[model samples]
Target: MPNPAPVPDHVPPDLVRDFSYFTGPGMCPMRGGDPQGALADLHDGPPVFYAPNNTYDGYGTWVFVRAEDQRRVLQDAETFSSHRRIFEKALGYDLPTIPLEIDPPEHGAYRSLLNPLLSPKRVMAMEAANRARAAELIDGLAAKGHCEVMTDFAFPFAVGVFLEFLGLPQSRREEFLGWADKQFHGTPEERGEAIRTVIAFMEELVALRRREPAEDFMTFVVEARVGGRAMTDKEAVGMGALLFVAGLDTVAAAIGFDFRYLAENADAQDRLRADPGGIVLAVEELLRMFPTVLMTRIAACDTEFDGIAIKAGDRISCPSMVANRDPAEFPDPNRIDLARENNRHVAFAYGPHRCLGSHLARRELVIAMEEWLKRIPAFRITPGTAPLTYGGHVFGIEDLRLDWEVG
Candidate 1:
């Protein structure tokens, strides 16, 4: 990036002591993943500085983004690996998550197994039922004066849809819900505890699937002797855990944000209330605009971008929240115009490593928006409550509190 207009070099005196320990290594959130602070740092300069592990994000600041450089950075994925070192170190296992951490020719093998499972046709088969389920979920909460969207609605909505797709039994609902909340969105200490709990449950679940071999994704994985030998017990457990960890929180955040958006924007809410038909595209645009989950990829080989050099093995993150809001691509980027042109956002990511569950996620969002809009025709945000924004870059939420009059 070319040099920018110079601003006065003034660091607050109190910030002086704070800066002493501030990695000065740029904006790694792991060192302390504060969205407001990170965005502040981003605005301060370009070619962002970073360390493998910063406080905001565990391996915080290394994942950096310059929206203008998105296309080229993703195109050369050979060197930008998704197999995060920090993540592997934390998990203590080199477990397979397939196309997620693999590169090129070898990656295609895993996709072969996953593609059929996540295909549009396969996903479409489940949509009608999920929509009904979503509608039912909203029906339970629509007229209430106040309700917590995440716990009462969004969390269960996404998890239930995923469980249905995997053919997992419904009895494990509370177990999965508690564990998922702690694992990703929980505090650092809580995250560690959540990981251990999830492993135990997944282990038992995988073992059961191996023995009976139901016609679910786990069964397909357990019995498929092709590509990779019938997946080991641990691998099956890990795969289930991976999907649970990745899918549930993301969908919840998206749904939660959709509600928050509508609660605040009467015009937008009115449009959808009169006709839920607008939900399909509106949800897509919302997903594009508010990326609740951040994307991470590690640089495998030394690379250069827009003249700045990225060393091999350097961890980097591209928060879709930033890319999706890019001014260059979306005119009046902040406005929630459902008709925005050239609307592809990296919210689901770019390149071949895009979300395998996109079909399911898209349908879920559509169903979620449609069902909620109809039930919640005229609702307002609770007065004296904080605004809703996805909380953190890694795992965020819409946290909207809405009330509507009955009769």
Candidate 2:
């Protein structure tokens, strides 16, 4: 583990806490771990605390534990810049993850250019393909009556749909998955290598699309104009790289968490199975209960928020799991209510920097759950075997061996 950075002089010692997404309680790898739920205790302390060594690169950050406070911090992008340069260390220079890392006004153009591609209507048009992919994977696993949900269905289903949207051939699924695994879950050196590998792939893709334009996403990007000019190589590569990284892991982790919940809570599974219409609402509830992404921001300049001192260049972490469980935000924050109503959870972060692929991700989760419940009967964690989960920049599940009677 990287050494935690020294706390800044401006931060109050009373407000500093020893917590991090990498090694905090319930954050470490464990069987049947509740990485999200474990942080609910934060609400009992200060709503905002300084956590030294909070990031993958071992930097201190002000941890915001309340939903409303997080909303203010995230929405006020001017004060809390989103230009985190998340891939800087790995790539050996600054390469903002476009739209995601770009702050407002300047961020608007890129967002507008890409929003239509993933709007609700566009996602609806892709529903058949998404559902088909989910069904295909589930059907293949249904007969076995037991399988590792993450590898057998979740990763393939989510990554395949994303690949299709990106206009990449399915033949490259394993290769992309390998890179995603190393990129998101590997050692620092491995992560840097994976980051370089993905950028190289995207660079090649941009070059290919420029030479041989096709009816695919990269083609459209290469041809499309932003600010009345075609996108530059770096811009194009950033767009593709962001999509590649964002699209691969998050939805799959969600599917794993959702299935794990259903497997453990048979009543909830049976309820959703009996009333398939409820799956949409149930998915929202599940997303609220088990979000995997952590939103981080850099203090654009020295600013005071909620009476806490923040310094320029300081990292700020707004964990979705922590905010979703804030008592002030949800009525019964801990309960898993499948039919939750008026749920405005920030499973996807708020403000202009909200996840661009959220529409497709939502439909994908609903379809995965709907198809799985419809095709497979009651299932549970395979006896004596545990699904190992861990917390980090992104939380994930592994060895999720679910089983059911083969009929």
All candidates: TM-score: 0.84, 0.99
* Candidate 2 clashing pairs, residues 3+ apart or interchain: none
- Candidate lDDT (C-alpha), each: 0.66, 0.91
For model 2, state the Cα shift of residue 382 in Å: 0.4
Best by lDDT: 2
Candidate 2: list runs displaced more than 4 Å.
none
Alpha-carbon RMSD to native, per candidate: 6.4, 0.8
Question: What is the lDDT for 70 in model 1?
Answer: 61
For model 1 the local lDDT of residue 361 reads 89
